[model samples]
Each structure stands twice: as structure tokens, then as C-alpha cells.
Target chain A: MSKTKNFAVVLSAVVLVCCGALILGQKVNAAGEGKITGTVKLDGTAPHMKGIDMGKDPFCSKAHATDPGKMETYVVGSGGGLENVVLYITEGLTGPAASQTATTEPVFDQKNCMYTPHVLALDVDQKFKVTTSDQTTHNIHPLPNPMTGNIPWNQSQPPGAAPVEKSWKAPEVIPVQCNIHPWMHGWFVVVKGPYATSDSNGAYTINNVPPGSYTVTAWHEAAGTQTQKVTVAAGGSGSANFTFKAK
Target chain B: MQRNNLRKWSSVFGAAAVVAFAMPSSAQQTKYDFETRMNIESHVGNITGHAKDAKPDYRRYCVGCHGELGDGNGENFPWVDPKPRNFQLGVFKCRSTPTGTLPTDQDLFDSIGRGFDRSNMPQWSTFTKQERTDLVAWVKHFSPRWVGEKPGTPITIPPEPEVTPERIKAGREVFARVQCWKCHGVLGQGDGPSAATLTDDLGRPIAPFNFAEGARPKCGDTDKDIYRIFMTGLDGTPMPSFADNIKPDEAWDLVFYLRTLMSQHSKEKAMAKQLGLKPVDPNAPAGQQ
Candidate 1:
């Protein structure tokens, strides 16, 4: 009877220890997580955006009967806040965080003879989808910098065609254009590690970074690139702001 | 009697000459001069007018083969072999520069003047130089690739080495060594065992170039053009760069050998025609005239 009681008591103690260890491990992982937040602002007057002429394709022109499309090269907002600025950590991240893959595919859509998002960012090797929702045909030609080791591709998608899924093998800032429409242009900013594009308010956040000191970079297509040094404490956040001179 | 015969023949010749001289000169002159004048006027107009406004010329000449959207699926596509070039994709097979680069304006001009040797695309040499230039510019507008991209600089071609019998024999050895006959048939007819399985980078089935047809090669048909293709294999297709494998002199030899193949094919075709053998049209329905 004594032996049986002792066995039950020992088993309960082991279970309690295992539970404690598991909780402790999770707590430690949570504690090390940090985020980088920042805003990108233009320092001067915003340039006048030019309106697009969709006269070539009747379908595109009819689609934008109510609201005409304009050049999205520079999207400025209140307080000179900039949009389409990509912010990413260029240094101080290692292992899985540095080479992490995105679970969801980033969608790039072509509608009304224009790329929906003028600027897009994705992790290296993450699959992205290209879809067209226009009656007219569109040719997607992405010209990557040869030095980036990414092979360039040009494909044509006619109306009602299946979506094209592709990925970049290396980090690059590829310029995509539609051969059918000379004015249709966009950028595919592929990068390694955590990255985010600034919203209309010019604010961005790159979360779940391991606690450390790092160099963050903000890249605007028209205004060039700016970098800042930041440090994050355990279970806390870091801040990095960038200001660009209007061109 | 001989003198009388000569006199009779001379009189007949004189009468024939008079008849020829009396023929309506204005009608023939007007037809010929009007065509020349129109050609000159269109050429000059193209130079002054903006290239973006060249739609009329494009519609008149290129739309029948290149399509309204430059998709190479025009009304004549069914009748054309090797198909017309699709500009929307922006993948030009013929270029003096490396693969994946745009051909120079001069290259396009030369192509327009020379035309493809075997293809349905006829030489537009009758068009004034300025008109051809305008056509090139209009064609370029079909693709947005020219918006921000600069054309690739042409590769430097070395001076041609002397061609000799021994050199051609060496080229034949190189051809066999490289297994050129695998994709291109032994006679360069594009009918090798592997020709059926070739696909491009986009997974679309593509055929090997038929050299014996003497058609407009995706690359130019000049010796230098052939050499360039041999050195820098076409990208996006099954062709690969042999710059690393073949020596420069050997490439020239291969070019000479290819020229011979084309000439031999031309000779056989001529001989067959002389023998009254009608050439079979591939597009014609089987078992019918």
C-alpha cells in the first residue's frame, strides 16, 4: 500500500515539473520578441501628380468613367506623410527570422489598365500571385537588376486567363510594366527578413523581431533610400523615423 | 534575193519600233511616277509627324500580319509558317546584343529592308528610309519595355577569318561533336527526335529553327548574325550559349557550314522546280488540290 502511494505521488510531481518548464519556455520566447515602428515623411511640397490617359483602351477608359486614374509615383498625405515607402531591417537578424517565409501569398492585381498597388514588397522566395481583372490583355514584364541573381520574366495574360504564381530567388527591386500599356508601371521590392510598407499615414511596423540592435532602411522609389540605427529592449519596441526631401 | 529579205526584215523592225514609241506613255508614266511620289511624301511625313500618331501606317501595312495589338495573331497567321513575331512579349530572337536585350534601331531597319528570307514577312525596301524608321518607332510603342529601358549596346564582332575547305571540314566535326543534329535534324530541317519536346521558359512548346528553309532567322541571316547566335544562345528558349564551349574560329566555320546548308537547300529546290515538280504547300488540306 505504501509503494502504491509513493508511485502516485512521484508521477504527479513529474507532471507538475513538465508543465512548469513548458510555460517557462513559452514565456522566454514571448519576452524576446520585439517590434520596429516608424513613419516616413516628405520634407517639402508634394509634386503635382499627372492624370493618366486611358484613351487607347476603351475598356479601361469605361472602367474609370467616374474616377480617373492618376500617376502614383508619389503619394503624399496630411503632414507630408508618404505612402508606398518600404521599411525593412537590413542587419542584426539571424537564423529563421532572417530567412523566414511568408505563409500567405502576396497578391498583385491588374485592373483598369493599372497595377492596383503601385508598389509591392515581399520576402525572397515567397510565392506571389499576379491576376488581371480587365477585359483587355495585359503583359507583365518584370525587369530585375541583373546583379540581383533573379531571372527576369515577361508574360502575357489575356482576359479570363488563370492567375500567374511566381517567386523571386534573390532580393531585388524589380520594375514591372505592361507592354500593352506604356504608362502602366510598378515595383516589386523583394527583400530578406522582416519588412513593411508605410500606410497612407506614412506609418509602418515590423513585428516579432528578436530583441537586438539593428539597422532599419526606408526606401522610396522617387526619393531614394534612408537608413536609421535602432535598438529594441526585451518584450518592447523600437522606433525609427525617416524624412525625405521632395523631388 | 538576200538583200530583198534583209530589207523586208529591216522594214518590219522599224514598224515594230514605231508601234512601241506610239504606246500611251502618260498612263505608264503616271502610274510609276505617282507611286514614287507617294513613297517620298510618306517618308517625309513620317519624319515630321510624331511617332505616336503612326497608327494609320501600322494599320495599313502591319496589322495584316502583326495584328492590331502586335500579338502576332493577325488574319494571315494561319497561312504563315514559323509565325509572326509577337511584340507584346518583348522577346526578340534576333539581336546583335546578348540575349534578353532589345535590338538596336539599326538592326530593326536592316531587318525591314532585308526581310526574312524564308518567311512571309516581305522586304519593305520600297518604303522610304524615313518610313521604315517611323514603323520601327510605332512598333516599339506596342511594348512598354522602351519606356525607361535603354537598348543594349551591340556586341563587338571580330573581323572575319578566311574560309577554306579545311576549316569547313573542321566545322563539320564540331557540329557532330556538339550534337547539333539532335535538336536540328542532320539536314538542319528542325525535325530531330527532340524537336517535338522543346518548350520555352513559359512552358509553351517551341520548335527548333529550320535552317534549311532559308527563312528569316530570328537572329539576322548575315554571317556575323549567325556567329552572334552561335556565341550567345537565345535566352528563354531551348538554345543555350556556346561561348564557353566553342572557340571563335570554330564559330565562323560553323557559320560557313550553315551557309552551305542553306545554299544546298536552295539548289535542290531550284532543281526540283526545273524538273516540273510542284512544291507541296504544307497549309493545303491533305488529299486535295
Candidate 2:
């Protein structure tokens, strides 16, 4: 009976060791994950963004009566900081690190007849939301090339309507627009790996990237895209700064 | 005449060569691949549809409008106003399924029979049922989507309630709540504020359906058809599905209210007339309808 007990104890210890190693393996992966940070700036004089005429919709015009709305084609901040630029690691990411879908949902709002955060970056298959805060009706239409495997969809959100939750099946730079307000335009930048969008200050940080050398790409709606090579050490961060010339 | 015919033949071959070379390799559908796709099949009721069977019929009738590639770039493409549907995209209006999803085989079959009103596509009711089903299969084979994905589940439609004055009033409220007037005018005249600026997915200018014009909707004319139209939405157009915001019971009410906007006489229209219903004031604050 004592011999049998000893054998059982040995087997249990072996199993526990395997479990501990597996847990440690996962923890090591999490600990080894780093981040990429960057700032995107406009190199030359900022182009003139045309003023939008919201006179067609009485509700929209009234909301922007005080400070007239202008097209967001190029929203350059102080110091030539470019806003609404999406950056992502386009190369070197593979396996779980590349295919991981974000769990946290991002909100894309329609406020004052304009899209809040004009460009939303998302990991492929990450759930995102479309919400309308304005009083008037807005139809949220995202046109993704069907050939790319991401289908296009259109939905209306009247005042007080519930939010619509959706996710992209593939990586694409889908254009989102409000048909009711033609001037209302935005983009959904979907990539397979971790991504980030530059804020008003042209600052962005892409987290959860495993240590590796990668080619990071930064895309702007009007100015097009730029890429730079970056390398992150274990538990350290890499950086790639982009400068787009004003067209 | 012989020299002219020879030149025409050469030009046709030249154009074909240009098309083959110019298109992106990813989008190209080689003749061999297209022929292999003929094996694709669709099931409608108990009838089986084979894409191979519809080739001759498509060449005879559909090739003039739908094109050889099913890209809707046929010889008549330039003259047609609202352009033929690009089947390569697999995005269709009048789907029983929700927006962004493929329509069921039955939906495609029904559309073949319904024949869009005010459109060049004539009613194919003259064709045998088998021919129509085969055509549906042929349509499916054009897009690679059919091979990878199944049709979306059709939305469940509750049994339509009898039309009553209260229902009509409630339907009007539903219409106002959803702000259908943003595109389809308050009076459903297709002259809403945004109507002039409306465009399809292809960026082509498209006009919203004017109920007051006395023309049947491009989808269908029955009460159920009306219900499906708003619930599923006419994809590829400015019209969007209200399924997310609308409850099934409320959707029926909106359908009844939409009927009153049409010039045709109906129970809902008669009840609306008796009630002396006025158009919802677009200026009224939301929920005041």
C-alpha cells in the first residue's frame, strides 16, 4: 500500500510540474510582449481643408452654427502634428501574436454631424461599435471591398437608437460614411496585428507586440501611407516616427 | 463587307486581350475556372438547380444585360440608368437576409419571378420553374463567396396583424421614430432632404423610391414584401436595414404606415384617409410624432 501511494504521489508531482511549466510559459510570453510608439507629423505646410456646408440638414447646420464645421481631410495640430493616422506592424508578427483579436470594444461615434476619431484602428475580428449622439438620423455605411472578404453593410441610427456592434472579417481600410450627411466621412483601419491611431497630438502607442523586428506601416486618409522598420527587445518598446508631406 | 467583318473580329479579339491583361490577377476568372464553377448547385424547395443548365439561357437572354462575366457590364450597360447589378460582388438589393449577407436561394428565385418594376429586368414568369432555379445557381457561381459561405439565415417575420386605424397611427409613429423621412420624404415622396445626395455603394447617384409616384417598389408589392423591405433593407442602395433599431412587431406597423404613403388604394390607406392622418412634421422634436 505504501509503494502504491508513493507511485501515485510521484505521478501527481509530475503532472503538477507540467502544469507549472505551461503556466510559466504563458506568463513568459506575456512578460516578453512589448509595445511600439510613434508620432506622425506633416512635413510641409498643411493643406486648406474646405469648410463643410451643412445647410442641407437643418439639424446638422444648427449644431455647428457657432463654429462652422470643416472637412477633416487634413487635421494638422500645433507643431505640424497630423491626426487620424493609423499605424500597425505589417511584417514579422506571426502565430498567436499576429492573429490575436482584441477583446476590448472601440466606439465610433457620430457627434455634431462629424465622426469622432475620424479614423478608428482595429485588430481584425475585433468587435467595434457605431453610435450616434446627434439628434438627427444618420445611416452608418462602411464600404469594404467584397473581394477582400470583408462585406459592406449599411444601418440607420435615429435619435436614441441602440448602438450597432460589428467586426471585420479581414484586414482592410474600409471607408465609413453617412449618406444623410454626405460630408460625414471616416475610415475603419483594420489590421491583423496590434495597431494604434494618432491622436490630435499625432501620438500613438501599439501594445502587446512580442519582441521582434517588424516593418510598421502608418496610413493617413489623404496623405497615403508610410512604413519604417522597428525592433523591440524583450519587455522593451520600439518606436517609428512618420512624416507625411502635405499634398 | 468581308474586310469589314475581319476588322471587327480582330478588334473584338483585341479588346478581349486588353480586358484579360488589364484586370487584376486576383479578380480574374479564367474560362477553365468559370466552366468548373458550372458544377455549383442551388436547392429551391425540392427542385435542384444546376449552373451548367443555365449557360445557354444566360447566353441567349441575360448576356445582353448581365454580361458574359456576370459583371453587369453588358452592351446595354452604358444606356441603362441605374446600372445592372455586378454579380461578382454578390451584394444584391431585395434580399430576405439582412444587409451585407448573401440572400437565400429562394430569395434569388423569387426576384427572378418578381421582375423589378421601373427597371429593365422584365418578369421572367414566362420561364419554367426549373429554368429560374437554374438561373439562380448560375448567379451564385459568379461570386466565389458562394463556395466559402452559406446564405445568411432569413429574418423571422411574425404573422402580420390585421390593418386598423390604431395600427396605421402607430406605424406612422414608427416611421417618425426611425426617421425614414431622412431619405424617403415625410410623405414618402423620395424627395427627402438627403434624397438628391444619395448614392449607391458604387458611388453612382441613386434616387430613393417615391411612394407617391404610384410605382411598385423594386422588391415586391405585397404586405409581407413591404415588411421584408424595411427589415432587411435594399442592400447596395442608400436604404439601410432598421432591424437593429426596430422590433418585429413595430416593423409591421411601419409597413402599414408606408402603405398609406403610396397612391394605391389599400385598407391601410383607406383607414388613414378616414383618420385624416397628416404627414408627420419633420420639424417636430424627436418622439413628438
Q: Estimate each model's TM-score.
A: 0.46, 0.89
Which pairs of residues collide in candidate 1?
B118-B215
Model 1 chain A: ten consecutive residues of lowest lDDT: A19-28
Task: Give one digit per residue, the lDDT tens place, for model 1 in B1-289.
Answer: 6545545554555565444334423322222232332232112332532355566878998899899988889999888865787765556655565555667666666777778656787888988776787777666665545543556777777788876655665665556544455467666788754567566545466788887775657657667988987666565556654554567878887776665556445433343334443322222332231
Report how far residue B196 has shifted in candidate 2, in Å: 0.5
The parts of candidate 1 lying over 4 Å away from their true place are A1-31, B1-289
Residue B105 error, candidate 1, Å? 28
Cα TM-score of candidate 1: 0.46
Root-mean-square deviation (CA) per prediction: 31.2, 13.6
- DockQ metric, candidate 1: 0.00
In Å, residue A220's CA in model 2 sits off its true spot by 0.7
DockQ of each: 0.00, 0.20
Q: How does model 2 score on DockQ? A: 0.20
Q: Give me candidate 2's TM-score against the actual structure.
A: 0.89
- On residues A162-197, what C-alpha lDDT tens digit does candidate 1 reach at each position? 787888867789888764465788999998878899
Clashing pairs in 2: none
Give fnat of each prediction, in order: 0.00, 0.51
